[model samples]
Target: MGLLIGVGVLVLIALYFIGIYNSLVRARNEARNGWSQIDVQLKRRHDLIPNLVETVKGYAAHEKETLEAVIQARSAAVGAKTPGEAGKAEGMLGMALGNLFALSERYPDLKANENFLSLQEELSATENRIGFARQAYNDAATIYNNKREVFPANLISGGFEKAELFEIEIAAEREVPKVEF
Candidate 1:
């Protein structure tokens, strides 16, 4: 009878560990899926850039420097493979895009162009999606990290590494702009 009881207890312990292992795997997969969502939104934003730039180019032919900067920034952003690299490249792209838009302000015709307006709206929507995806990814990563660090799971999490948060390294991006009525 004692032999049977010992075997039963061992089986329960093995089951408990297996449960924890499975939960960790799910959390890791969720974090990865969150990142892929961000990537998709980023791709949409990238696709809109050339059209926006081309529309601006027709109106502001002399603004070659700003146009080239936007193109270069877009290339860097597209080439980024990891979250860390993407964050840095995206910051540059954002600044380049800001410059391009400011250049458009100088040319009333560019600002009024229907294609430019449409592309700008689409890019803005994509940026919003990217922001939401980043939030979701960071939340998932935090949850996974917590699961891996907690006592019971940490014992089982020997194989699991902490997931990286998609962090913005740019000080400007982190700062909130003031709005006054």
Candidate 2:
């Protein structure tokens, strides 16, 4: 009777460990999926940059520096490896875009151009999607990080390191350029 009870307890412990391990695995996958979501948005933004730059080029022909800055920022964002690096690059891109939009205020024709307006709308929509994705990624990261650190989960998740916290890519200016005004 005593041997049977001891074996049952051991079996329960094994099952508990297995359950926690699975939970950790799920959380990690969620975080990864969230990162991929952010990646998609970033890629969309990158693809749109050249078109945006081209549209502005005709109107702001003299603003070579601003256009070059946008291009450089986009390149950096594309090459960024980690979340921290990506955040900084993304912020730089945001600043460059803000400058690009400011030029629109200087050129009424550019703002009124249908092609420019449509591109701006698409960029705006993508930015909104990126924001949503960031929120989701951060949420997933939070859950994963918490699970990794939590007592029982931590024991089971010992093999898996804690996931890094997701950074919110807020531009320094904190506001998207109101280029239309």
Candidate 3:
């Protein structure tokens, strides 16, 4: 009877550790997947920016400063290495793009151009997708962070090096700027 009880206790402990490790792994993967979702939308936006800029250039050749600003911002965004950096770069790019579009408003003919209109619609939709993806990333990160740091999970996570937090978010100041336009 004593040996059976000891064996049962060992099994329970083993199962507990395994469950904790598995949860940590699942949480970490969820966060990674969430970040990938953001990456996809960001890449889509990046791919569209050049076309959008070119379309605008055709209509507003004299707006060199605005166009240059947009190009610079896009370049910065592409060069960003981390999620935090990317967020800030994307915000700057958004502001520059907004300026470009606002300038486009001055040219009634540019606004009337069917190609420009189409690109604008697509860009707007992509922006919405980015917002959704960002939300998902934040949620996943929160879950993983909580699990890895919380008491019971941390016992196993710390011992096994189960999961590590990802550095994808920064302070509000560094986050993506709201698109007011």
Candidate 4:
């Protein structure tokens, strides 16, 4: 009777560990999927940039520096391999795009052009999607990190490494400037 009781307790412990391990795996996969959603949106944004640049180029040929900066930022963003690298590159690209739009104000015709306006709108929507995806990714990462740090799970989580959040390091850029009319 003593041996049977010990075996039953051991089985329960094994099942508990398995359950925790599975939960961790699911959380990690959710985080990865969230990042993938961001990647899809980013790629869409990248694909639209060349068209945007070309449209602006037709009107603002003299703005070589701004156009080149946008192109270079786009390239860096597309080449980014990790989440941290991608976030930084994406921030730079956002700044470059902002400069390009600000320059567009000088060209009334470019602003009026239907193709340019359509592309700009599409890019804006994609940026929104990217924001949502980043939030989801961070949420997933937080859940996994918490699970890994919590009591019983922490004891078993030694075999698993903590997942990294898709964090943007560009604090200054993320802030909105106070614009008082």
Estimate TM-scores for all models.
0.86, 0.85, 0.82, 0.83
Per-residue C-alpha lDDT of model 2 across residues 1-181, encoded as one tens digit per residue: 9999999999999999888888889988999999799789889989999999999998888899999999999999999998778888888988888888877887889989999999988887788888888789889989988888989776667688776655644663223444435
Which regions of candidate 2 are displaced past 4 Å?
81-84, 167-170, 173-181
User: Which is superior by lDDT, 1 or 2?
Assistant: 2
Superposing all C-alpha atoms, what RMSD in Å does each candidate have to the true structure? 3.2, 2.4, 3.6, 3.2
lDDT of each: 0.79, 0.83, 0.78, 0.81
Candidate 3 accuracy as lDDT: 0.78
User: What digit string (tens of lDDT, one per residue) describes model 1 on residues 8-34?
Assistant: 999999999899899999999999899
Compose the digit string of candidate 3's lDDT tens values, residues 59-129.
88888999998899899999999866887888788878778776876889989999988888888788777
TM-score of 2: 0.85
Per-residue lDDT of 166 in model 4: 58
Report the candidate with higher TM-score, 1 versus 2. 1
Q: Which window of 10 residues has the lowest lDDT sum in candidate 1? A: 172-181
Clashing pairs in 3: none
> Candidate 3: minimum summed lDDT over ten consecutive residues — where?
171-180
Candidate 4 C-alpha lDDT tens digits along 1-181: 9999999999999999999989988887887788788778889889989999999989999999999999999999899998678778878988888788877878899989999888877777776676787888899889989988998998878877887775644542232111100
Instruction: Name every residue pair that clashes in candidate 4.
Output: none
Which sequence of candidate numbers ranks them by lDDT, best first? 2, 4, 1, 3
